[model samples]
Target: MSEAVLETRDLNKNFGALQVSRNINFRLDAGARHALIGPNGAGKTTFVNLLTGVLSPTDGAVLLNGRDITHMRQDRRVKAGIARTFQINTLFAGLTVLENLYLAVSEHLGRAGAMFRPAGARREVVDEAMAALDGLRLADDAGKTIRELPYGRQRLVEIAIALALKPKVLLLDEPAAGVPSAESHLILDVIEALPEDIAVLIIEHDMDVVFRFAREITVLVQGGILASGPPDEIAANAEVRSVYLGEGTHD
Candidate 1:
């Protein structure tokens, strides 16, 4: 197997006496389509936080391409090729879709200071932003403000922003959460169409999405991994079914 683009070594996290992640050794290889699923309070969010440098692990290390980045700052992590989207919408609600993506693209290029200039003046940034939107099939909505788009489209915009950063590892937190059933498929379609070279890890409660999008699934329960394998094995794992899937619990 190839070396993991991202990894955790005996990862652990705690809040005083409560342990949220324990000895969580994990890996995301290049071009991996993986899912991290668990019930509520299963430490899924905490684990992602630790990986993104949003929260520090009590004891352990985070590695990117075999280099230790356990204490790296969040923004630095992004520059180092790790980018993520949140469970909730984090876009500039009042900004047009193009504007929001432009900001991210510019920041990723270390040209954020040039954003004060007219959009046409920064042709490269705008082109890259447009490319991301076009890939997600959101180019038609570019002129609309995020607040004006439907909830589902808003989620797509968040993804577009993440892609504009040109990450090697893309961490998606509940990409379809709160989306109507009728529109959730749109998110799935986009996910399935992501760049083949970028390792994508999705944290989601929706079983259908999880099963369909993940080539490999890891079940996190009580701050630990209960199972990790292909989708068929995960679905058949009694422990995972009992603790998460079978219970029909939301994370």
Candidate 2:
């Protein structure tokens, strides 16, 4: 069988006396779209940190393509093909959409030698950035500063930035946290249409998008793995229903 692109075995974390993540086991194959979901305080964010090296796990291992990277630094993890998007949008506020993407592409390509050039003059870099923008349907806004775009479009650009990194694993924390329903749908479409080479692990509170996009769902409660499987199976599990879904509802 092909090796897992990313996996965590018995991963644990603590803050003072509080156990934020407890023996959480997760695995994602190449090209898998795995969704992590739970009610508030379920430790999903903590788990994302563990995988991305933002917060070191108090115990256990994180293996990327079968190599131990449990304690690697955050920047090292990004260099190792692990890229993430924050819940809040992060972008180059004063730069145009094309310029924002150009930086991302340049950062990944390690092209610091050309940083001084006018963004438009770097024909090859600009072309790649424009292509990425076009892929995300933001090509028309390429010339506009990020601040000029709507909240939703800015969010798309954030994902595009991560995509420019050419990650093998993409950890997204609440990609649609505060957008309007209509814009959220657009974000979902952008997410679903991501290139097949990247493995997407998303933490979302929106059950509608979770059920629609996830092929596999992992549920957490109080920092522990409560259940994980296909969405239909998890949605039907009695314990999950009682702990998360409340009484008498199959949603």
Best by lDDT: 1
**Pairs clashing within candidate 2:** none
**What's each prediction's TM-score?**
0.95, 0.91
Write one digit per residue (lDDT tens) for candidate 1, span 66-154.
99999999999999999999999999999999999988998898888764666568788889999999989899999999999999999
Flag regions of model 1 displaced more than 4 Å: 114-120, 249-251
lDDT of 2 by residue, 1-251 (tens): 44699999999899999999999888988988889988789899889888999899999999999999998998789989999998888788998888888888876776745657665575767777878888888889999999999998898898988887879999988999878877888899989888888889999887788899998899889999899898999999999888887732555
Evaluate all candidate structures by whole-model CA lDDT and list the values in order: 0.92, 0.87
Assess the local accuracy of residue 42 in candidate 1 as a C-alpha lDDT between 0 and 100.
96
Q: What is candidate 1's CA lDDT for residue 28? A: 96
lDDT of 1 at 46: 92
- Residue 130 in candidate 1, Cα distance off native in Å: 1.5
